[model samples]
Target: MFEVGFWELALVGVVALVVFGPERLPRVARETALWVRKARTMMASVKEEINHELDLQDLKQSLLEQKKLPNTATDNLNQNILRRRQATEILAEQFEPGEAAPEKEPHD
Candidate 1:
């Protein structure tokens, strides 16, 4: 993000070495590394949480669509079943006493 090139980094290192001296430079570098690592980990965790929330919203929308379809399908199925049952009763009444039962076939 800083977009620092090799020359910039070399200049910063030279300045740091002169200002902090060899004795404190390594300790400062170590502390800086630790802080950067912590910041990156925190940022990653935040990103993951945001993504999880977005996924949950998408899942909720999918479930809502699925929920509507099933209700409509169930209502249609109930109407169809009622109509078939009425037709079956009418057919049964028309049959003669000794007539065979209606053929039972499974269809999809």
Candidate 2:
């Protein structure tokens, strides 16, 4: 996002060299690079978590709307069964074998 020209970078380098001297400049630069990398990774994780929370809110809103629909008892029962089956299938798709599944209640 920074639009630093070659001259600006050269100026920064000159200043750094004068302030740190030849002996400590390389170590300072290495530490600066590590800090920049860690900041970038932390920002990415924060963005990902925010997006996940927004998606979860959207899903909850849609589920509430689904339950508010006017329908007969038979239609409501069928829709709930269908919804549960869809949820189970979604969970199954995310798992590798048995690693991701939750225990289900036994249906008689």
Candidate 3:
């Protein structure tokens, strides 16, 4: 930003008065103020839009991460279930069709 001090502002005002003249200076200054106000409003609107879009991006990213976590968890659960089923099948194979499985020894 430009660091315009009080003297610089006075100098610019004197120049503007000389250039624009007394009759047109007030109108010109008013119009300039209006344009500056409009520019500030437009900049604020654009800044708000950018922040909103960034928030949405963050939300979407978090949702995607959450979605991935559940899928990974589900996949792990399925894999564990499959492993257990395989172990159960192996155990079943150790017993004949009509034979009972051996009783397990209790842990101390």
Model 3, C-alpha of 8: deviation from truth (Å): 1.2
Off by over 4 Å in 2: 70-108
Clashes of each: 0, 0, 0
Q: Local error of candidate 2 at 60, Å?
A: 1.0
Which one wins on TM-score?
A: 3
lDDT of 2 by residue, 1-108 (tens): 789999999999999999999999999999999999999999999999999999999999998877767456668899999999999999778885958566899999
lDDT of 3 by residue, 1-108 (tens): 579999999999999999999999999999999999999999999999999999999999999999999899999999999999999999889986899878999999
Worst 10 residues of 3 by lDDT: 92-101
**Predicted structure with the largest lDDT when compared to the true one:** 3
Q: Which stretches of candidate 1 lie over 4 Å from their true place?
A: 74-108
TM-score of 2: 0.63
Per-model C-alpha lDDT, please? 0.96, 0.93, 0.96
